[model samples]
Target: MLSRTPKMLLQTPGARRGFHSIMSSLVPMVLEQSPRGERVFDIYSRLLKERIVFVHGPVNDDMASLVTAQLLFLESENPDKDVYMYINSPGGIVSSGLAIYDTMQYIQPKVNTLCMGQAASMGSLLLAGGAPGCRSALPNARIMIHQPSGGAQGMASDIAIQAEEIIKLRTRLNGLYASHTGKPLKVIEQAMDRDLFMDPREAQEFGIVDSIIANRKAPQSSGKQ
Candidate 1:
């Protein structure tokens, strides 16, 4: 029975902290052995304990896939618990970011998004899309939103089709932002016309984040363990 259970599972606050440190130490050695070691040593094992998911670096299909899986798995483990998402991304593929965003909403647990460094473009969308009243950013974090840009080179007709798709996507994004921020769709479109950048205070004012985390600690999760 014990063998059937997860070996890296850490219960209790102290255990989570202690094992997190231990796993951090083990990650380098594990990486030396296998390139895929991060999946086992760094992300999944640590995630199971803290129920925290990090969306670091540029958002892409692979990153989106992993994050979606983690969110679903965490929800499957405990639907009532709040999941914390730490995002520090420069942004990337639109569809990829939307995949993660959709999954965030599909999951039952409330997701609390905290911008660590920057959440620009699609990253900004994900931040704004977090559970209302739960989105936040570090004091120095930057947030940005802008119209989607795409490239099409096959033919003029194809380019026009791509342009149309981009317009539709931009509209969808604007609607989502307006829904989350309580701002009007036209306002969102205007703000997204150019790269609108914001610091924590500005982001909060712009409705990209609910609060600025100035306490230097992770924000509290709303759900009981």
Candidate 2:
């Protein structure tokens, strides 16, 4: 029985001002309530012996941190089990996104990404971070990659620092794209610069995605297997 009512205690004046503080304390519980929690609870309730974990939702620092912790836990407890990642997000902060991607890569889990809606920008990068043979996207869903952009403010030196940061970000972005798609770095950079949005079919054609989940067919070998 999940509580649908917003907790009024979280809405009080003092609570409002310290909302972040209080939320930080409750973040663990909220994150567990996300897809991961449901999967764990289901396994326990059904008394199943197999391992299955679902990591899904909007990309944010807090959520990434939570998922990272869970991934670490899984690696320690059940290192051989395949971890399913269901991604549906418009993406978030660059650092947060990269942190999640790095964490996933560190675990080296067999991650199957079932995109129910959209996996755009950083979300796409995270999906690509999965083990080579385990990455995937649903047929009706979309995956988009583009140049990273952010806002900055400060003095002349500060502006120069921000410009440098953007250049580095773009370089990293291009590297990720080239590694995943096996396309020429310049070609991937051009597509990202042009803000390409790819459907599952187009992604497969471009070698950005390994296989299409259409017609209820099983995933094809990604050449890594």
What lDDT is reached at residue 5 by model 2?
20
Backbone clash pairs in model 1 (N, Cα, C under 3 Å; residues 3+ apart or in different chains), count: 0
lDDT of 1 by residue, 1-225 (tens): 122211111011111122224334645322324565533354445554688888776676667787899999999999999999988877777888889999999999999999998888878888988998999998889888887777555666766777788888888888989989888888998998887888888888778888777775755332125
lDDT value for model 2: 0.63
Query: For all candidates, what are the clash counts?
Result: 0, 0
Write one digit per residue (lDDT tens) for candidate 2, span 78-102. 7777776667666666776787778
Best by lDDT: 1
Error at 156, model 1, angstroms: 1.4
- Return the TM-score for each candidate structure: 0.78, 0.73
Q: Candidate 1: deviation at residue 79, Å?
A: 0.8
Q: Global lDDT of each model?
A: 0.76, 0.63
